[model samples]
Target: MITVVLPTRDSAARLVHVLPLLVPAAVDGLVKAVVFADAGSTDATLAIAEDSGARVVQAAGDAGARLSAGCAAARSAWILALGEDLVLPDAWRTPVEAHLAGGGGKPAFIAAPGPLGLAGRPLAVLASGEAVTAAGGFKAGGDPLKALLGRLRPRAVRLRI
Candidate 1:
């Protein structure tokens, strides 16, 4: 079972779109139970989650904190911290399960809010049930054409299509 921990603040609308895509037990016994940790949302975020059978936790503070709280609520062995602003994919279930089950690696996937490098296979990096790119070493700084460089990690270079 893969516990997908989604962190949100005022994300009611987006959750509605993201929720339905995670069902039907696509990867054998791999159940995708959702945990929505709301950062003191005044909107209908919790309600949306409740209606969708998601476990909701009342949270406080930033994205990382909310994600941490949600991950703490997760019951699965592998925890996936996702953003509320994003819509997760349904097709990813099979690939992630297959990748993790390989047992040949300890995967950590970090994703930016953009396309990955051409040399990097998208599914291998994004759908490996690992952390996303941003969690790896990249940062998004408002420059649409480039990733902000992090000194302690991989150098960020502007990629051209």
Candidate 2:
């Protein structure tokens, strides 16, 4: 099971694309929860997140700080930090389920495809709660995901999505 952490700021439009992808996984019991780390959104971001059954965490700092707060609030043993705009393919759950069933500890990544369905860059972090917490729960400045990746240096799983 995994808790997804999404950092948001007036991201209702983006969430509309990504949240639906997770619903099936949630129903299948693969997604334990979704946590929205909001940075004072004045739009329907909060409402949408709440309506989707995502726990809203009001964080007032940068993305890293908000991510840290979200990670802290996660209740699962695994954490999946996803960018709000990343729309996962329908088959995402299979590889992720395999990763978790393989005794998840090291970090794994899912790359977002480029235009024309070309291979793209890694876009998210999926790892155990301990690994994330040990990495200091994301830095307070700069690219937090990159910072965490640099610290963890996990073997690339290259989850094909």
Q: Who wins the lDDT comparison?
A: 2
Model 2 worst lDDT run, 10 consecutive residues: 82-91
Off by over 4 Å in 1: 26-28, 103-105, 110-161
RMSD in Å for model 2 = 2.4
For all predicted structures, in order, the TM-scores are: 0.64, 0.88
TM-score of candidate 1 on Cα atoms, chains taken together? 0.64
Query: What's the lDDT for candidate 2?
Result: 0.81
Candidate 2 Cα outliers beyond 4 Å, as residue runs: 84-87, 114-120
Tens digits of lDDT, candidate 1, 1-161: 67777777888778777666666652445656778878877799878877878898876866556665666677766655554454455465555555557634444333343545433321112222333323432222332111212231242222221
Error of 2 at 30 (Å): 0.5
Tens digits of per-residue lDDT, candidate 2, 18-117, equal 8888998999899989999999998999999879999999998877888889999999999888754555666778888888778445687777787897
